[model samples]
Target: MRLEGYVIVSGDGMLADAGGSMPDSLKFEADYRFFSTALDAVDVVVHGRKSFEDQPNSPRRRRVIVTGKVASLADDPGNAKATLWNPAGAPFEAACAHAGVTEGIAAIIGGPGVFAMFLGRYDTFWLSQAPRVRVPGGHGVFPGVPERSPEDILRASGLHPTDTRVLDPAADVRVTAWRRS
Candidate 1:
């Protein structure tokens, strides 16, 4: 399966606010549309619990939420659209099967650790940066990794910038897709 990462960060490479949530200052309609479209193109979406919870339940997409529990949404009474998976307890392939995702692109939209989990595995990283916003003391996109810059982090994982497009010039938001060379 082709694994891909989708994230929107600040100029300083912060992915979330200090409160462990997406920064309000980085919210833009264009960016939201871009993300929504990308997710629509993918067959499976993988994200952390917090990111999944923040979004409204709709369209019932096949999704996997990284969690500590061994149970899946199939086992849960609520949220039949998603599956809760613990990578340490269950294999990724198994999780995909449980979600009924047999193949195609799997988009990893995250909160730090989930980003790190698919670092070298990601075929492409749709990295969006908002230059007008700066989230000081916010959560880094790769929390455990020691890399100083997001570019360096991706390069270290063997991915290089393939293309960059300005999604919104007025907001100074741009998206750069990094892929394995």
Candidate 2:
């Protein structure tokens, strides 16, 4: 199965501010549009409880919510199209199956812990960055941040970045898709 990650981080490698919320500085219309379009192409969306996407056709989409609430795989009480999964109790493939996703592209959306969970498994990680934004004393995209950049972690996981493309020059939003060899 093809697994991918989508994330936008600050210059300091943070995804959210100290309040456990994404800062306004990191939110760009261009970035959101890019993310929304990419997500539409994926078969299943895997994310933590707090990392859900709130865009068009979200409730109708197949989703696997990685959570500690379920021992294994369980139907999501909140959404009929979603499943609750605990990696400790079952393998990722099983969870994907429960979400009705067998062998297709799966997007990995996150809230730090989920990103770290699927660190080395990503076939392609589309990392978006706001070069002018820096969230100091904020939540990082990965577990070992402030000590290491997100690019460093992806490289260590055997992923190489392609040429970056500017999404919003005014907002300094740029994206690079890191693919594993």
Top of the candidates by TM-score: 2
Alpha carbon lDDT of each predicted model:
0.82, 0.91
RMSD (Å) per prediction: 2.2, 0.8
Candidate 2 per-residue C-alpha lDDT over 1-181 given as tens digits, one digit per residue, 9 for 90 to 100:
8999999999999999998888888889999999999989999999998787789878778999988998999998878899999999999999999888899899998989998888889999999999789898999999998699999999998999977889999887899999998
Model 2 misplacement above 4 A: none
N/CA/C clash count, model 1: 0
Worst 10 residues of 2 by lDDT: 52-61
Best-fitting candidate, measured by lDDT?
A: 2
TM-score of each: 0.92, 0.97
Q: Which 10 consecutive residues of model 1 have the lowest summed lDDT?
A: 52-61
How does residue 35 of candidate 1 score in lDDT? Answer: 87
- Model 2, C-alpha of 81: deviation from truth (Å): 0.6
